[model samples]
Target: MFEQLGLIGCGLMGGSFALAMKKAGLVKRVVGYSKSPSTTDRARQLGVIDVEAPSALLAVAGADIVLVAVPVAATEATLKAIRHLVTPNMLIMDVGSTKADVVQAARRALRDQVGSFVPAHPITGREVSGVEHADAELYTGRQVILTPMDRTLPEQFAKAETVWNALGCRVSNMSPESHDAAFAAVSHLPHLLAFAMMNSITGQAEGDDFLSLAGPGFRDFTRIAASDPKVWRDILLSNREELLAQSRLFQQTLQNIEQAMQKGDTQALEDMITLASETRAHWRMGAQRTSKGR
Candidate 1:
């Protein structure tokens, strides 16, 4: 709906946004930027954007909307680089997995311009990444969480919502602190645990053999562990506090299971298993609602 749109990283999320905008016919102009020439070239080949810029500022300068899609740790650096170039009319947003750090970083860099910013996290992403894997329908029927605090004006917030809704996404607003705390428990902690579990057995002497012997259960549990390590590492560092708490809870649960097994309490172990199964079933069905809506 805006005349100018800026995408600050032509990777998975940024590239996908380009594809979505092109397919939906919502934007007449899109300017893209990337530190990696190969990625910028690939996004161009995909017809994801009209022009590519040499620097972050060139991409963002005067654009009505700017989406900073980069590693969580690199967000502040990107914001700092482009903060001066961003006008008050430009709507700033990010597709970060961690929110608190990103919001704080933007506030530190933009100050008054922060009122025009919208901190957002789309709950949809693929295990694989890159412009080649980008799909316009990735956001369709998906839930995009916006963490716009009190300082953000209602008009600016509405502009952010309008853009996402035009892309077929349902918008839900949350506080930055709440977003980080929740994702730490549900998204970040689970990914870390999966990586740990896979590494626990895979790091053994016969790592390859252990991997070869893994059944479907092991395969499913460790799938997320295969996601981009750099991105995961950045998210981990950004949300370390909440993740640590989640890890402690997992450790305590493991201890409880150990105690039950040692005491030969079959009922207790089965009860725990059943409870986990039921909860997973409910959540899985809930996720299906979004997928099926697509």
Candidate 2:
């Protein structure tokens, strides 16, 4: 068990993590800090943290494990804030959606102490965000991607894996570049499409009327459009390169379908639809197998 967990951000992700650690008996104490004083105070009152820290450095003062749960844009500044107190044995991790930029931030901010930092991306969250919405079961049975740098300490890496595993997470390792690229296609690009789909509909004069007629399909497809704007904004920008590449590929496929429609080619349209339906069915089968621990 860790002696103390120094939590930065104190919002949904950080607060949930602290609660999970406490539930699993993985950490003895949690000291939390946030950009907003009220947030830190609320986290303490909610029992998400045992102590309130005034600054990031103070939060890390005596903690053996630290979680930097800030936005992708604030990662660099947050790491620099606590770098002075970072120790070789301390295991630091982040929950940012994108990994490449986060790894770069750690390298620049921590320098020789970078070995203590292990970049992590936990694939789970709710549409609502804040300390009040934090759930102890947030990471349970979810996938967590860890991207450790070459300089990362083996002992610290092992501890990081143990902590997440204790919380009931399925932990996997990947390079920062590969992690970012893969997520850009699976996660980031979908958020981008959701945002655009919402805008495209709402921009019309009959938008409200059209929304009234939306069925379960539309609701299911557009659920992610209601995600926190600022958080998604930072994520989309941080992994823009890979996201854009995926977007171009999506456009190519869309154009092919559109051309088939223009030519009134029923056979081509049916073929494309069949291909997509079969692909989605195959993916669902594989996903079910993985969920059963195959």
Candidate 3:
């Protein structure tokens, strides 16, 4: 359990974290700060944070633990802003989607505080945003990745693991680069595709009919595209290289399907469809098994 907990960016993820920690009695106090005054006010009234600080630097000054639950693009600036307030004894971790940049920022700006900084990301979320949607179980049984290198101390990693485990997470260790590349493919690219698909069909001739006939499958496919514009735009820009690599793969696959269609190759089209169906099934089953097999 931690005596003092500080959080930056009190949005859905950050608020949810505070709720979960407090519910588990793992955090005595959660002091939160955000760029938006309205968000801080909401967090306080909703009991997601105990105290609202005027600034992030003041918010985390004496905290035993800190969680930066912001978009990936904001990680460096946020770390630099609060580096002076961090102590080597504290545990500083982030819930940013990308890790390489965050780890580098902490290493450079808060070199002495690196050991206390555990670069982390939880592979979980909802389409909705804001403190109002903060759920107590957002991270329950979710994969929380901790990407540490040889420069990291074992004791620091252990302490980080303790905090995440107490929050009801299944922790996994990985490198920052690997984490970014993997998520860029599995998470980022999908979001990009969904947005593109939605944009393409918005003004099409069948748009009206599509809207009226939209079913569960279509709705599900475009759900992630409905995420916060600012957040998704930042994520897309921040993780560009890895995401572009994944996008290239997607483009090639689409080209293959287009070529098959041009030739009226029903067998090849069938093969692609079958492969996609099987792949999706595997992942769906794997996710269910992970959540329930325990």
Error of 1 at 249 (Å): 0.9
> What clash pairs does model 3 have?
none
Model 1 stretches with alpha carbons more than 4 Å out: 284-294
Per-candidate count of clashing residue pairs (backbone under 3 Å): 0, 0, 0
* Cα lDDT, all candidates: 0.84, 0.91, 0.85
| Best-performing candidate as measured by TM-score | 2
For candidate 2, write residues 176-243 as lDDT tens digits. Answer: 89888998988898899999999999999999999999999998888888887878899999999999
Q: What does the lDDT come to for candidate 3?
A: 0.85
Best by the lDDT measure: 2
What RMSD, rounded to one decimal, does every model reach? Answer: 3.1, 2.4, 2.8
TM-score (all chains, Cα) for each model: 0.94, 0.95, 0.93
Instruction: Give residue 254's lDDT in candidate 2 (0 to 100).
Output: 95
Error of 1 at 140 (Å): 1.6
lDDT at 242, model 1: 87
Regions of model 2 farther than 4 Å from truth:
285-294
Clashing pairs in 2: none
Q: Could you tell me which 10 consecutive residues in candidate 1 have the lowest summed lDDT?
A: 285-294
Cα lDDT over the full model 1 = 0.84
lDDT of 1 at 58: 88
lDDT of 3 by residue, 1-294 (tens): 789889999998899999999999998999999999889988999999999999999889779889998887788788889988777678888888888877887787777667778888888889999999999899997888889766666777788888778888878778889889988998999999999988888869988878788899998988998888878887888789999999999999999999999999999999999999988777751254232211
